[model samples]
Target: MKNAKSMSRHRVAIIAGLLLLPGFAFAQQSITVTSWGGAIAAAQQKAMQDPFTAKTGIKVIPEDYDGGLAEIQSQVKTGNVKWDVVNVEAFDALKGCDEGLFEKIGFSKLPPGDDGVPASKDFAKGLMSECGVPTDLYANVLAYDKAKFGANGPKTINDFFDLGKYPGKRALRKAPGVALEWALMADGVAPADLYKTLATPAGLDRAFKKLDTIKPQLVWWTAGAQPPQLLASGEVVMTSVYNGRIYDANVKDKRNFAIVWDGQVQIPEGWVVLKNGKKTAAALDFVRFATGTQPLAAQANIIPYAPPRTSALNNVTGATKSSLPNAGQSGRAVVSNAEFWSDNGDDINKRFSAWLAK
Candidate 1:
């Protein structure tokens, strides 16, 4: 009788555990997603997150953070991760994964970018990573006030550095990422050898030397919005601006701005899940949903940053949205090399900073 009672109790416990396993997914009714603030967040809310809730009944709590992994590192160290999923730059996603602070993604689970192509084949090169899903695409492109130059605007990256020809104060974002790439390209560095050459000290010096040629004419901008505002007010003539900012300026604000897609450096933002978060499973589901073809395309309508999915691009309408940075970007687009930047960015930024101080 004792043996039978013990066996019966074990069976009851197993049944209870089995029942709870199915309920576990539905237990968390909400998840917090962190992203860059302003228009990007608004678009995600309308296009992705809201639709996700309506379909899965999982509430999405949206939050904003400046791009970096320091806070995430702290969260993981303290075992108190508040963000289920974070939208990070390519290098951040790469570095965070290398450090094991983020969960290693299972790329096989992601839906195809197009029906005929696998997920791995669909994304533009360097967009996919072991730890993150590529979300939206953007470019560091030059935009000029159409009122100022109109027909004779600086048309190429080479033209941007040609101070004697298109003489004026030009603005660049205060970072070594795209600016250095542009510097090398403007100095006749072939697009294919950008990172290979940048690996050498001679190449680094060459980029800085190219930058030095226009130091006096440079207006350094830290924020994305500053370039367009500065351009409208005549503070800078042609500014290195995000394509979306230029899109907003022309379509929404009625500012006379035109983007020079030539020599544009494309950067893809990623969505990452932190390790050991309670909501990790749900977060993965949300990322899978948010990065789908239609959802990504919907985001393009709200903001001009291209969708990473090739199928998503098919859903985008209008000439403005159609021309977003992509794989076939007219031979002038350089996809940012996340691995190289992850390896060398800190040291490069230090050198770039010292040069700026001097």
Candidate 2:
């Protein structure tokens, strides 16, 4: 009888262990997401995170960072990752995936669009990648204080470089990514040949040489928020700025600013999951919901960055349409070459830094 009792207790213990398995599998409660802060973060908070929490019962902890791979790399290398999901630019997504810093995203798992199109087909062409899902489209655009140039403001790509024509301090982002492309274009490199030209040594020098013309009069900006501020303070007459920021300055803050759509360098931004994050399942669910048609469109309503989803773009209408990167872009825009930047960013950034210091 004692032996029989012992066996029954052991069986009961085994049964209890089996009962807890499902709880363990479904226990995810919260996740952390990181992105570039400021208006973009506020827009995401309203459009994505708040709704996701209401739907999933999973709390999202938001964090901000200046754009780069350093923080993610340290978290991944140290195995103490705090961020489950991060918003990354296209080149960073490609480089991070290639370096195994981010989890491989399975597009098949994402829900179809509201229009019933598959996620794979619904996203814009050449944007789907192995480890990230494209969320929105933005551009580095030439924006100026309309009051500074009046109606005769800098019109063409050439005019941005023509100090003698529209002479004043011009603010350029201190990065080589768009600056080099703009330099080459200002020097008359055709849009179709931009990447090919930037690929060679002589072409690289040519871009830097062109930049040298405006170097004396150039005021460098490092943050997205700074350009609008610079223009407001009259520190610079014109600056290359993110489309959304300048748009907000005009429509929201009532600053008199205008975008010169010529030579806009448009690029896609996406959501990426950190490799080996503790909340991988929850992180991916958040990414799916955040990149969905409604969420992408919702963000565009708050800011002018275009949605990358075909279905989501349909939802964007009214005043936001006039602020988009594609507005008045004509045929003079360059879609950023993500692969070229992914491969060469580090080397070019180093050269750019050395030049900046001199």
Candidate 3:
């Protein structure tokens, strides 16, 4: 009887050990990705999470935050990091790299080429070093209500200021992300000379003075969706809005909104891995999968935002064409200088906010 009891105890211990094995393995492999909370997040869910789990058997959980880097910094400071991978703006990516918040990625791990995207050092191997990869390219373009403008709507940034001709309410982004660039362009400064002129006090003042001309007529918008809605409701005849949001509103509401890509402010979204996470390897794999051509193409199909991968562009179907910025143009247009924004964004934002408030 004693021998039988001992044998029974040993079998129970074996069963318990087996039960705990899978849990341990699961604990070893889980990645939390952080990104902006909106359509982009939905696109990521459809394109990345479902496919990656099916292929790699790795579970992906997404965490949404308004300002991803700020949240990451808070996490790091408190020593309770929750995110493994983060979707960051290029400027924030640079800032994160400077503060040692990213890891070096291994280029060899990245999948081979994209034909649809322009060739760039923008996507290279290694963590924190080449810390971010361009995921999507969007623009802040002039969107006008076709009914309001009729056949004589604004066609460029210069036209956006001609209240006498294309008269109606106007809207612009509250952020200085592209306001300075647009201001300079409206002031007849060449795109190439925009940054050069903006570096000086006189040039910045000139830009502000140009903005002052339209201040009362301006309807400042803080949300991406606001401009399109304002335009559709006839609150504003023309507004500078994100290309994707405008496209979405146009499709869903059948509003006669058209985007003017000329002199548009291009903004590229970038993906970066977080520095303080337990699942670094898994997070890197997620980044590789998320930015890879296949997944990116899937996202472009559902949204107006274009992937930075050259090959992904070819996958964009006719159904998605209406949302693309410069759809009327033959090829891709120039991308904005993210590095310049990184260096000057804060100062410009502060000044613009103060000016607007005053």
Top-lDDT structure, candidate number? 2
RMSD of each: 5.9, 4.6, 4.1
| Models sorted by TM-score, best on top | 2, 1, 3
Model 3's lDDT to the true fold? 0.73
Residues 77-98, candidate 1: write the lDDT tens digits.
Answer: 8999999999998998999998
- Candidate no. 2 TM-score: 0.91
TM-score of 3: 0.83
lDDT by residue for model 2 over 1-358, one digit each (tens)?
9999999999999977865875443344788989888778888999999999888878889999878899999999999999999999999999999999999976797888899999888888898789988988899889889887799998877788999888899998879988999999999899899999999999999999999999999998878899999999999888999888987788779999988888899988899999978899899989999999999999988988888888998998858877777656654898898899999999999999999999
What is the TM-score of each predicted model, taking all chains together?
Answer: 0.86, 0.91, 0.83
Question: Where does candidate 2 clash, by residue pair?
Answer: none
lDDT against the true structure, per candidate, is 0.85, 0.89, 0.73
User: Under the 3 Å rule for N, CA and C atoms, how many clashes does model 2 have?
Assistant: 0
Clashing pairs in 1: none
lDDT of 3 at 262: 74
Estimate, for each residue in 1-358, the C-alpha lDDT of model 3 and write its tens digit.
Answer: 9999999999999977875874455444678887766667777889887788777767888888655366788776676878888887777787777777877664555676555333343342221236776677677788888887677777677888887877777988777767677877888888878878888999999988988888889888765667877987789878888777766666677778887887776667777777777788777878888878878888888777767765776678858755665356432234566676667777877897799789
